[model samples]
Target chain A: NAGVTQTPKFRILKIGQSMTLQCTQDMNHNYMYWYRQDPGMGLKLIYYSVGAGITDKGEVPNGYNVSRSTTEDFPLRLELAAPSQTSVYFCASSYGHGELFFGEGSRLTVL
Target chain B: AQKVTQAQTEISVVEKEDVTLDCVYETRDTTYYLFWYKQPPSGELVFLIRRNSFDEQNEISGRYSWNFQKSTSSFNFTITASQVVDSAVYFCAPLTGNQFYFGTGTSLTVIP
Candidate 1:
């Protein structure tokens, strides 16, 4: 169904390098979120958007940025990749307060 | 303050054995949603179940079941007769207002 699609399944970046993780959903959900998962630590929300052109920060919003330009797309940008930023990122979309449908995830490694 | 807690870090059970994953969450909001997610070795997240705080009845789906108790602030998941394919990491998450938080996931191993 291509519920939520994320590009760059895996990537490796050097310190100070920048990249964007692309995410798009076809479910027409209004709420979209970006989360990062480390080795053993739980998933931490980086940013979220309730609708187009609206974004908000979550628990660990540092060193990350997100933009919601359309109802079907929400992209997360790593302005300055750091060693601590090596983790897997997930993009999810939900219909209002409904269940969240997550993407396949993008794994990034920063050296 | 930690909103969701999964005390069990890892659990190993043989095939055809029952396993229960514990999840405890604390939230001040009366209206909230609790959910469980499964991440297998494939590195993809699968949504298992979603329960609202007001629903006091337990739910069963095939070999999977959920016990949601508001008095103890816990939402536990149990898998009956677990097979080798059931091995994966389970995460408990709670959504309060517009904020959603996930627990440190419990890794499960089903040995055949």
Candidate 2:
């Protein structure tokens, strides 16, 4: 079964460039989240959505943005890529308070 | 604020040896959930186990076991007779409301 799918597994961007990390789930879960993992660090939440049209900021929301237009899709946007934004991003979804299913992750590099 | 701590940064054990990973959490919410996830070299996360606040019973599955003690705010994972395939980074997460606060993770190496 296709749990969570993320596109552009790897991307390299120049300074001030912009890009979007796409995330979609086929499980029809309402809770979706975006997290970034830096080297030698834990995953930090960037944004989260309870349902379509409802979004909130998480621990490390700066330099990033997200939108959940449908129940299955939550895309993270980087307006002006910075070196600090280079990290592996993961998308996850859960049904209610159930277990979370994560994507394969997208590794981004900015120079 | 909720927090999860994995004091052990890295642990190395030979094959067929038992290894234990510690997880400590801090949360003010009376009702919460705890979870363990394994991230191998493939970079994909695999769910290990989930425990609720009221459940203190230790669980065992195959060579893996979990100890949950709400009194001490600790949920530890143990692998008996670990194989080389068990080498991975283990993360502990405590969920409160809709947010999950994850620990920094403990890297385990199962040498053969």
Candidate 3:
């Protein structure tokens, strides 16, 4: 089913630069989430979408934006990237509120 | 608000030895879900097991077992005859509705 897929597995951006982390799932899940994990720390949700055109902020949503235009795509945008935004980002999807299926993760470094 | 705590930062054990990772969570909702996920060095989170708050019955899956205790607000995972392949960071998470909260995680190293 390809499950969940994320593009740009690794990226490095300069301060003030902008980019989008792309995520897509073929499972047709109703829920999609974006999370960031610092070194040796737990994951903190950045944003989530219940369905197309419906989005909400999570624990940490600063410096980032998200949009769910369709059931298969949920993209996270980083505007004016900062050093604080350097972390491993993960995209996950699930049916309802059950167990989540996560992607391999995208490692970002902002200098 | 829901919070999860993993008191052990790191644990080390020899191969073939048993190890247990402890997790404690706090939530006001009577019906919730608890989960255990494993993240290997590759940085992919894999779902291991899940238990609902109402179901306190412990479950054993091959060499892996989980104990969920409602009274103590604890959900513990045990690995019997552990192997070097089991070395990874384990995270405990509690979910309420569509939101999920994760613990700090416990890193386990099984020395071969």
Q: Best-fitting candidate, measured by TM-score?
A: 2
Q: What CA RMSD would candidate 1 show?
A: 1.0
Ranking by TM-score: 2, 3, 1
lDDT of each: 0.94, 0.94, 0.95
Off by over 4 Å in 2: none
Tens-digit lDDT string for candidate 2 (B1-112): 6789999999999999999999999999999999999999888989999999988888899999999999999999999999999999999998899998889999999999
Error of 2 at A54 (Å): 0.6
lDDT tens digits, residue span A1-111, model 2: 799999999999999999999999999899999999998788999999999999999999999989999999999999999999999999999998788899999999999
Question: What order do candidates take by DockQ, descending?
Answer: 3, 1, 2
**Cα misplacement distance, residue B112 of candidate 2 (Å):** 0.6
lDDT of 2 at A39: 86
TM, every model: 0.98, 0.98, 0.98
Deviation from native of the Cα of residue B51 in model 1, angstroms: 0.6
Instruction: Give me candidate 2's TM-score against the actual structure.
Output: 0.98
Interface RMSD of each: 0.9, 0.6, 0.7
Lowest lDDT block of 10, candidate 3 chain B: B93-102
